[model samples]
Target: MFFEEHTGLHIDDQRYRGSGTSKANRMRGFWTVEPDHVVARVLLAMIAHATEYECVPADMDDALFADVHRIIARLNQNPSSPVPEVDAFTASVNELDFEAAAKHIRTAIEQNEPATAWIACTCFR
Candidate 1:
């Protein structure tokens, strides 16, 4: 819930705008102190560096969540990698169920999967 509480600080519509340079900078301020924010920072950097057009809130969310689903599916399908937490989180995300995602995020945090916690906070918002 640490990242959840901080979501209001930088996860606004404005943060998803522009080329993501500003958001990446803002994310640096957090990840420097809290390494979990590296997920958000890296994602923002991808937008900032890879795209020619300015980023939009809905587009960014959709692209990110779409890839999230793909990654989760790949992980879940691999018999050697049984990630039930990721499965639950992806299920919550697929349903657009923010409350359920939050619970899974809390579980992720407790499980020490900070990257998942970051993704849940950034996407579910």
Candidate 2:
């Protein structure tokens, strides 16, 4: 919901391209961020560097870091589904081993782990 509100693009609407449905007809389709979108790729790279160095980039301010931490906190609330990589990433962040955290984040993304990737993306975006 936050993403939809911020991006003005619904995830569900991504499926309606060329469907000719009324809702799809009324609005543009394929507007949602794709996993391989340029913005996502650029952010991921920045996150990797920042995490590796354990220092926020000059362009990324304190407020962005706070938002990232908030997102991570929300994700941590749901521990029923155990993801070892996510757990390790969180630990890396806590220990200030940003490079290790970046590694874990990359793995999470490669594994199609949206929650983990979302945390990193939101932080940098």
Candidate 3:
């Protein structure tokens, strides 16, 4: 996986600490513009925000996953809700950058969606 291949980046530890041993347990992300930081907002969709997995509670996974999928689809098809920092980074990427794709994601996070942010940062770590 992307994370295992890049273990040298030290992103795994930053993303997960005292968390448990499940997909959700390792959702807390350590995002930044740097290679390892990974732009948290883009990560929010993966693992369905980790909220479903993180809590290990009951039935919450269903809802979280639904929301995550919705967010993912919206980003894939929509063009208006760009992430906050996308314009600045676009010049550097080939133009189809996932990093630039993170703008809408950042907006989603602004709604106090910590679970999404956590999942995003850790998903590709």
Candidate 4:
């Protein structure tokens, strides 16, 4: 819903391809020209949306929040770093507990820190 409403990207559950390799150990799923570019785009879009409107209520889950935080911390650590290792980053993202991340986002919104929430959520996405 958020992607559709904010970025016009209507990605459904079925379209969410799994990360990692296939049965043959070959990588699968779509590969962008630059993975970091994709991340930047999503983050920017999220920030723009959050800035333009009131905070929207979202689920807050613990495990997911931890994963999101991990990702964001990595990104923030070296904002100018070249495109990150796609496989490693994807692995980290796949390990996230979506429920926990949702909880974290909700907490951020409740605290009126929508920008932080947006960065976390977008990183996971």
Evaluate model 4: give its lDDT. 0.49
Instruction: Give the TM-score of each candidate.
Output: 0.26, 0.27, 0.25, 0.26
| Number of the top-ranking candidate, with lDDT as the measure | 1
Cα displacement (angstroms), candidate 4, residue 72, comes to 8.6
**Positional deviation of 70 in candidate 3, in angstroms?**
2.0
Best model per TM-score = 2
lDDT of 1 by residue, 1-125 (tens): 33344343444344443445575654555544333333454444445544545544545677776795465444333334233444454443356586677677777766656567778767775
Give stretches of model 1 more than 4 Å off.
1-96
* Inter-residue clash pairs, candidate 2: 51-98, 52-99
Cα displacement (Å) at residue 76, model 3 = 4.9
Model 4: per-residue Cα lDDT at residue 19: 49
Query: Candidate 4: which stretches are off by over 4 Å?
Result: 1-9, 13-34, 56-125
Candidate 3 ranges beyond 4 A from true positions:
6-9, 12-29, 34-58, 74-125
lDDT of 2 by residue, 49-83 (tens): 67888786577788887786565445434434444
The clash count for each model shown is 0, 2, 6, 14
Better lDDT candidate (2, 3): 2
**Candidate 3: what lDDT?**
0.45
User: What do the candidate models score in CA lDDT, each in turn?
Assistant: 0.52, 0.50, 0.45, 0.49
* Model 3 deviation from native, Cα RMSD in Å: 11.4
lDDT, candidate 3, 1-125, per-residue tens: 44444323444564454455354455443332232123323454334435555854565568886785676555444434434432343333345345633544465455544346545545423
Instruction: Name the lDDT value of residue 109 in candidate 4.
Output: 52
